[model samples]
Target: MNLNSIHNVYFIGIGGIGMSALARYFVANGKLVAGYDKTPSEITDSLRALGVEVHFEDAVSSIPKSCLNSESTLVVYTPAIPQGHLEFEYFKNNNFKILKRSQILGLITENTFCLAVAGTHGKTTTSSILGHLLNECDVPLTAFLGGICENYNSNLILNGTEVSVVEADEFDRSFLTLSPDLACITSMDADHLDIYGDASELKKSFVDFSKRVKPNGKLFVRNGLPIDGITYGIEDDSDYSVQNIKIENGSYVFDVKTPKTLLENLQFNLPGRHNLSNALIALAMAVEYGCPHRQLANALASFKGVKRRFTYQIKTDNFVYIDDYAHHPEEINAVHQAVREMYPNKKVLAVFQPHLFSRTRDFIDDFAKSLSQFDELLLLDIYPARELPIEGVTSAWLLSKIANKNKQLVSKQDLLKKIHESNAQIVLTIGAGDIGEEVKHIKKEFNVAN
Candidate 1:
């Protein structure tokens, strides 16, 4: 089970965000890395640029010959990969040591001083912020993030061997595999109902993750979540709180109050109150890790956000375009609040692509309510990532529940023409599926219009 003895690492679903991050980590550590993905993507292209061998075909023959040794080569696969996947079955039949993505992450982080971020939403942004904070402070840290960080332009950040930062994902009970020295639960909203039947089971998973923290370690939670941890919130009486908030020139200027003292004049360029709370938790965790106060403040000030998390594609006075990976009701609500607060009185149009059939079925009412806040809505069909189609779940069915009169279900082919016809001042493309791949095209169309 020793990683040091492995000479090669192969991934069955290599194009995934988390899987790509681990691929980068193994390659950076001087191990030969290769993988098979169902499709080639920007992530796969980036890995190839880094000298990792990646192939699109999922057959066993697609695997490199160098990875044939069962003892020296370790195989990793994501939960999204099906049981009948050819490469996966090949690896299993050969008796090679195989691990799930989460299990491998748990193994890699076992000996390091780990800072794990867990939540139904905000796990990626929170972990990325913590990674950037630690990196800016020059801490001896390594971070395996769930998204591409805009600051480093990579999901894996390696600084030193002393500490590690990870996004504790809750899908399929993934976060339970992690043993963290310092952990935070950013939210406990009901999600992934296909995996955990109801909200109570989801909350129990978070509680279980909290218990996985080292006995002497600390856990940070949002003020209202049902968990025992140091609380963080904005303008609230939490252990670590953000107060004196002001928005000047589209940036948040706030002060953080910790148990010992108040850190004054904290500046975060990211929009929304949710991001402010994200920053506060990151700051508190950095301080707990012994990062200097001034260093933490400086890091927060210079921190750039993660890609697809409230990412600004085109920001101008006349027109604003944002892309966010908001797939859940609560996340969509956060995006709505952020957009409305930043550009009051401006006409806003939202284009959302539902992620999964089960999720859409479980929270159709909630999604309808959250999406109704938009001035205009463009709904796309559901993006079924890993689930079979639910009998009654469809984007049109969900769209029918929306109270907004200005809503229409559009195809991807007509998306650009629809946007061209709209006069909305602010446009947001929100989802956690292939909708993101359309951001560049949408931005190009906007640029041409200008």
Candidate 2:
């Protein structure tokens, strides 16, 4: 299955962030690219703008005739696609060369020097930062990221063929497909319990991923994670660590202590100590890839963040609005830490839409505790991405566990009205669901009030 032999690339779930990145990659490489998604989205629109034909309909007829050749056309699909999907069934029955998104990433990145970032959280941001650092350092690199990079304004970063940076996704064990020259596990938090069933299994999967690093390649893991790798952490003992960190003029100013030397006064614009850890891991990896120390520092300063990962929508003195894709308890805790460190006195209002019913059921207590840190809370019903509704798992049930007195469950229709009525200075909408689609409206409403 040589990718060079393929003339057309068809995606079954092209609207997904990771899938769209691959679509862009194929289209950029001069291949005929088209796909079907369940719904139209900004991502699909962007792919279409790039000359990749995208249709929202799921009917088998929506697939282009160009993709009919089973041998020359590559059919890629996300695991989230249903087993009964029409286009999927068409490809399956026709004996098309089908590949999972991760398998395709592995195939494309095999010959290149791959820097794979793997974890339950922070994979997107870490990979995006690494890509930016390499590009700024003038390293000939290409990065396939899982989120839209604000600096490049695309999930796929292309420069040269020598190096490839990618997000090593853990969902559906996708990261296992990648054979990385250098890999980092930013976190191994228990998630996707519907898949792994427990935290230990999730940890074992990460351990297996770490072992997948090439014999001579490097593996970086966050400190204290249950794995053997060169460790990274914030102001702690690890092979690479950030120390003397301070927020200066709205950016994080810190020093990274690596195995060889201490890179001082490193500047990262992203917020949070967890982000600082992310930056440190990216910096270390870039240096290992032969990027100069000074170059790493410069790149860190210029690296813009990933969209929806602690993304600041509005940053004015009077009002601040942030949007994050934190769907788990550990991620929410990181967000809480960032907000408290930045605006200690400001009243914070959090609007969270739980991602899946299974996750909500597994970590309801943890979610309740993390969300309680907010001064006020507005909880939306679960998003249920690929899960059937579990009995007794509802956002209202989770909201009831929150200790905050200023908490209520609200519908999307009344979300804006509730925000307008609140006196909180820092407003955050946190989730890994359709809540992001509402960010623009929330920002517009705040701007109009201002």
Candidate 3:
């Protein structure tokens, strides 16, 4: 089970954000790396550019000759990949040493000084910020993030093994695999009802993840989260709190009070109060880990943020365009609050693509209420990431529940035209699906039309 003994690393779903990060990690360490994904993306293309051979097919013949060695090569796959996958089955039938992506990650970070960020939302931003802060403060660490970091342009942040940062993913209960040196649970909202079946089970899972922190390690939880830990929030009584908040030149300027001291006049460029909370937890964890105060503040200012988390695609005096990876009701609510706070009177048009049928069914009412807050709404059919369409679950069905008069369900083909027809000054493309793939076209069309 020693990673040092393996010379070749094969991934069944290499193009996934988390999987690609691991693939990059292996390639950097002088190991032969290759894998398969269901489709090609910028991520996959980047992996190939790094000398990792990636194929899109699911055939057994697609497996490389180098990876066929059962002893020297490690097989890693994401839980999202089906069990019936040809390469997966071949690996199992041959008695190959196969592991889930999380298992491999846990093995890598188990003995390191691990800082894990766990949540239904904000994990990427919080972890990415913490990684950036630590690296900027001259801490030697490796971070495996779930989204592309705009500053680094890679999900894998490479340094030394003395410290490591990771996204403690909750899906498939993956975060439980790691025993972290320090951890944060940002918000334990009800999600993955497909897996947990209800809210109480999801809360229990967070509690389980909380206990995975090392014996002497610290745990940080959001102010209202149902757990016992060091708490953080904005303008609230908590272990770490942000106060004296103000917006200067479109960025948030705030102060954080920790248990020991009040860190004042912190500057963060991201757009929401929720993001401010994310920064606070990152600051608290970094300081608790012994990062210097002045250096941590400097890095927090320079941190660009994770792509697709309230990412501003285009920002101008007369027009504003945002694309966010908010697939849940609570996340969309955060987006709504941010946009309304930033552009008070401007008309906003939201184009949303629900991510999964099960989620859509579970939070149909909440989604309707949040999406209705926009000035105009354009919804696409649900993006079925890993689930088949559920009976009676459809975008049109959800759209009908919205009380907005300006709402309509639009196909991807006609989406640009609909955007052109809308008079909203702010345009948002919100989802956690292939809707992101359309951003290039939307931006190009906007440039051409303007």
Is candidate 1 or 3 superior in lDDT? 3
Each candidate's number of clashing pairs is 0, 0, 0
Report lDDT (Cα) of residue 319, candidate 1: 94
Q: Could you say which candidate leads in lDDT?
A: 3
Worst 10 residues of 3 by lDDT: 441-450
lDDT by residue for model 1 (207-248), tens: 899999999999999999888889999898999999899888
Model 3 Cα lDDT, one tens digit per residue, 16-93: 999999999999999999999999999999998998999999988988899999989899999888758888999999
Candidate 3 residue spans exceeding 4 A from truth: none
Ranking by lDDT: 3, 1, 2
Higher-lDDT candidate among 2 and 3?
A: 3
lDDT of each: 0.92, 0.91, 0.92
Predicted structure 3: clash tally:
0
RMSD of each: 0.9, 1.0, 0.8
